[model samples]
Target: MTALGELQRLRASRGGPPRKRENKAAFLFLLPWFAGLLLITAGPIAVSLVLGFTDYNLIQPPEFNGLDNFNRMLSDERLHSALRVTFTYVLVSVPLQLACALGLALLLDRGLRGLSFYRSAFYLPSLLGSSVAIAVLWQQIFGAEGMVNQVLGLIGVQGRGWISDPSTALSTLIVLNVWTFGAPMVIFLAGLRQIPVMYYEAAAVDGANRWTQFRKITVPLLSPIIFFNLVLQVIHAFQSFTQAFVVSGGSGGPSDSTLFYTLYLYQRGFNNFDMGYASALAWLLLVIIAGFTAVNFWAAKRWVFYDD
Candidate 1:
């Protein structure tokens, strides 16, 4: 046969050009998410990176300032204070929040009465945690004449304006952050439920106490879930803006005690119209979060037990 005829015969024997129907279906399904990533996410990130090296206010065109913004941070006392506040908040709130969540999840895992109601009630705070209304409510709750002081008054323990005192203002915010433990609680409950009951039974037959089993089996198995929540909460805490902003009344006030990193960035960007500096701050935050996350993943190898 001629070469062309042989190729045609081979094609006929096998199949036509691959249609890639599955790939096309997957691409179709993923189109919206891909579009969002490019436009809403990646686009802004790229623009912000470029803007970080340039001086730009909303009223003027950007002028390249090289590393001025980053350099300015070296001498910025406010930036240091903001970083201190942010790190303190994250370090304190995340572990406490996770602890509260795990404790409540354990309590709920005991097959208690009205379990659904308890779960819903506990989770309600997380739903409203980031809302302006919640922050406003928090301000009232901790205000001198607010509910907290009112209770204190009955107990004859005088209270000051919790949100207005630099010393106590940050603590109130920390308390607020800790109160929103519901989301992680749910995750813990799910992880707890996933543990095979037989493991507990086996441990019991081996005369292992509750603490022993919990330390050995529960902690090891649940380490993965704990790691996941840790990473997410750390990132969330770093990016927190609304609570501090609303509570501080957009001032990061009471002696800058509530000046979270994101709040400082917002003040710089919009309030001061220092978009370039704000972009730099944003980039710094991105680096910090990425570094922490990388460390967490690295550290996970030592502790997080995966069944894989």
Candidate 2:
């Protein structure tokens, strides 16, 4: 028989096409994921969108308020402060963190002894950095009579409460953010390993120095990795709440110097029971992060290099 006739005979013998059975199996495997997307993610997102336009204090029915919550953001001084602090934190910490990561990645790429140990040790911070315990430990470390002050005193220098000073509190938080550079460092190391050693050898044959090789070969090749890390780190920084909440004692205090945008949203939602306004703030943050990510993607056309 012809192939089509044989296939039809096989299908008839099986009572249906095999594809139908395969599709049903695939769909069955994916059903749980689809359910989760609808119930856990899409459902709450849709509800939050609706809540953004209503006044709901969790104690009463939600009353539609139109654009009042968004309008209120225009004159909300604390909200503005939160925006400024968040922007400052993202801007200062990301570059410093990436620089530190890249530097360490370069050092580790040289086939150092016990490289796995070093990588694991470096990666531990990124894993624990956002945890409540780490934030609490950070708070203690920067306290007036904490380890930092004790070390300073050993040098005959008096150390004030770093987390209590409005001018310095944010800086301390920025330092903490930068210290979690392990994630990007691991990514950078992987990217570095993928680079062909022949490129460096070729550059050396042309009398190029180490800086020239790095500038001409390493950077262009690794630009995509750098851009990837940048986008992820920026998004992560924007959503940061645990560290600021814990370090600031859940208040964003010290004159609101460390008031991250998400922390303020938490304060409004749970603390003041202003769920409506908090929902609006959450949407606004969504817009802000989307805008920044879009900008980065648009800008990437000029810099990010693909092997293809």
lDDT of 1 by residue, 102-216 (tens): 9899889867899999999999999999999999999999998999999999999988999989999999999999999999999899889889989999999999999999999
Tell how far residue 236 is off in model 1, in angstroms: 0.9
- Look at candidate 1 and tell me the lDDT of residue 285: 94
Off by over 4 Å in 2: 1-23
Per-model RMSD to reference: 9.8, 8.6
lDDT of each: 0.90, 0.90
Q: After superposition, how far is residue 94 of candidate 2 from its true place, in Å?
A: 0.8
Error of 2 at 216 (Å): 0.9
Residue 187 CA error for candidate 1 (Å)?
Answer: 0.6
